[model samples]
Target: MEPLNNDMSSIPDRDALPYRDCVGIAVFNRDGNVFIGRRKGSDDPERSADFDAPWQMPQGGIDKGEDPLRAALRELYEETNITAVSLLAEAPEWIYYDLPEDMLGKALKGKYRGQRQRWFAFAFTGDDSEIDVEAPGGGKFHAEFEAWRWERLSRTPGLIVPFKREAYEKVVEAFIDIPQRFTHV
Candidate 1:
């Protein structure tokens, strides 16, 4: 009998795989802090290590033919249950990130190599009571986060998975001035 070969080289080239189209939202509160959520770890042991740094902004796949901005709004409400928000700014360009070699064929349902994201910054205008991580999207959508909190924008990159750090850094740069704008409003 032959043993199973669990080699990565046997898989297709990761660079050749397509990136998932997605939208990321930076929901800033009146204090200028951005929202972050601790991802709910998967039951798969092979993928458990991916949650080492689970905190992330609200993000999700973009529906076919959906406008990027609308997708951002929908993802925000679905993930955080907060509808009172106003657009602050948008990243000048899409940011791309590749999954780690080990995660390439294991993550994103073994479909996407990573994500190509359009990011938006929004000023959260509702109270804290509106935020619900346990049963987001009015319980219609699967809960992606187990807990959530407001964090400093500059610190986000360090809080997310290493493979997605660069993307988070770019998002921070693109919306760096947004928080300050709310200070005087």
Candidate 2:
């Protein structure tokens, strides 16, 4: 993975840029493990690679006027192909993260400085057979992940890109009790 570009001098106006509206989903299975996927490397050669910490929970942009929860469910199904789930919890407030300085103008199509995400946690009630990361949502949505797996929720922060790690940490804190809640169910 490429090192996080720390030079902020080049992107002096980044703070003025708007954050992309988005939703993030954390789907936990019967075992209390959370679902994560290995993000496919960017097709753009100029973008930094994510090989170092490529795993992340399913997330995506929220269309204008879309309800956050609805967007969360849509993104989850679109990215993971698992629709059998029950709402577990929602973060009390939106979590925000900034793109690294180097990514300010290069990521998110150069329109946003970062993402402001509303996160939802759901209990996965379906069998693992329902997962089809290779062609999620029956291929209606573009594939963002190359592979997928179940992982401990506590380990997610360490598995995501550095720029998004803090947001993941807040997510873990918000839903930390989720696993135990489903452990005996």
Candidate 3:
């Protein structure tokens, strides 16, 4: 065997992997509690991380030429069937997270390493009857949540998968003042 050369071409470029651009929504009700959903089913084995918490806020990919704010609203309506909302706040910056090693080349159709998310906070003005996770708007995608509820924004980090906890924490911190500004019915 000949001596191995330090050719950079032989090494895979981790930066070459693209991160899917996506958006997340944290819809808050009258009491300032943010919406959370319990994912409908068990892990796909390939895409899911080993975490007990299934609850998370509404999130999805940003379509071609679609604005991040628009994508946030669209994903919110498509996932929760609620539309009566007013913008509360938007995160100061985009948050990025990577998939676990086992899922790196399998999740998201192996198209990207993970997601780069733009998170938005909205005030839910509609009544509870407006929410129907089973049949979302336009019906483009299947129901992602089996059960849903409103939770304290601060507690969200613990309820999400470990890999996504940091992003959730930042979101909560960025919007921490939201409740004080909109406490009225």
Candidate 4:
């Protein structure tokens, strides 16, 4: 295998894969409740990284030519019908996590481990009723969260995939100054 260069021109061209680098926004309300969702078909609803199902913050793909902040905003509206929320704050750079090898297809396997994700923290400025994962292009292809709720954002890091844990820890630490960080937005 050859070294992969992030440089746009040096990379060899190939068909696109669905699993790409992305930005995941962890939006919360004023009540100290961090935003979370139930994956559509997740076998385990209350899954931890060590189990079958686990709750998580809102996140999505970072399309080419899109900055992580922009991607975070786009995914916010797309997944939750959250159109007018305020950007309380954001992480400095990108956070990455990889899909399990078994979950990959012929197309997804050739590239990076999984996704290089950036997580943004926001306060929900709109009504909670506005969250509608069914709006249009939603739901995970395999695992899906069954429900959503607001919880302490500080605990999110220990819950996601092992590789993503560090990113989770870093993001929450950066945004610690925000009051309650999760609550009525």
Candidate 5:
């Protein structure tokens, strides 16, 4: 991983870089609210522990030959213990977001300039008790979120880090038809 540099030597030209292939999961509850987590880790550019807007939905890199839907479900399960979900919708197009210059090659292990993500919206079918941010404690990933909540989709962009705001905004618009797809139970 490229270390976060104070020097500008490592920064790559924006248009000359590639975007990482990733998937973003937007898990919606029965009430039509979307799930977001308070990111953990200070000094982390993506999470920006010091920033007031530190919340984001579950997302992760798509492994080689993996199906996007499966990857979305896998990321959702790994980050939050909620597997009972019914696919609601998928974005009509992929969304891209660029990393701030400081994170151009430093974040995502310096692999890509930013993320080109496929977003999915799913309706939660399990009871709230089934969701757990903390699970398999001794595993590779402990907990990416310190807390979690379901919020109105319209407010998602405001809760996300500035760099990811455009992606979140697109996600919200892409899935704006969600509420009608799932009736509150």
Candidate 6:
């Protein structure tokens, strides 16, 4: 398998984009609010991470032979330091987004031109304190914001990449009622 770049340079390009498979997750809390993290200043270009990276959702790629649900749970732990050891993740459906015409990777320069992703929704059964942004492994966007909150289902606070907004809306719509909090994991 190829190494996952922090900037995703390994994926194919627009037009000729090769097949790149990945996954994303939208995690909701008991109040039906979504978890969105604000990134650090050093990591964002033009400091957009403060706005765009601000509390979107947790998502990552599926490893070879690894299931997407498992990948989602892994990403939850890796990125937000939120563990699913206590909560349950139901079977999630796959959703996808194609990179814009100008954004496809070089390898996929001529292909349908972008990434195909599967998205999932999980209600966090853990406490906010369970999330340790300082966790030891996994890639994290350096953009950081001291403020974090539970966003309502009907609300959208931005920070979500333009191309991914619709997917976030869809995932939140599907899994908003699972549970608010738990500690079994």
Which candidate ranks first by TM-score, i.e. highest? 1
- Candidate 3 residues 1-185, lDDT tens each? 99879796633345778999999999999998999988877655322556777889999999999999999998998999989999978899999888766666666777677899999989999999899888787566589888899998999999988778888888888899987766775
Give the TM-scores of the predictions, in the order they appear.
Answer: 0.90, 0.89, 0.87, 0.69, 0.88, 0.65
* Candidate 2: RMSD to truth: 5.4
Clashing residue pairs, backbone N/CA/C < 3 A, model 5: none
- What lDDT does candidate 5 reach at residue 7? 86
Write candidate 1's Cα lDDT for 111-162 as tens digits: 8888999999999989999999888877987788889999999999999888
Better of 2 and 3 by lDDT: 2
lDDT tens readout by residue for model 2, 139-174: 898878889999999999989888899999999999
**Residues 1-185, model 6: lDDT tens digits:** 99866885555544554445666666777665667665444544323432344455666667899987787777767677677443335435556666554444322324545456676666777788876655413335332334456766456524566665676666656555543443245
Worst 10 residues of 3 by lDDT: 41-50
Candidate 5, RMSD to the unseen true structure: 4.6
Q: Candidate 5: which stretches are off by over 4 Å?
A: 1-8, 136-140, 180-185
lDDT of 5 by residue, 102-178 (tens): 77778888878899999999989999887778661234456888789999888999999888889899998999989
Candidates sorted by TM-score, best first: 1, 2, 5, 3, 4, 6
Report the lDDT tens digits of candidate 4 across residue range 109-138. Answer: 456446667777787777877776655234
Of the candidates numbered 4 and 5, which has the greater lDDT value? 5
Q: Which of the two, 2 or 5, has more lDDT? A: 2
**CA lDDT of each candidate?**
0.87, 0.88, 0.85, 0.65, 0.85, 0.57
Candidate achieving the largest lDDT: 2
Clashes of each: 0, 0, 0, 22, 0, 29
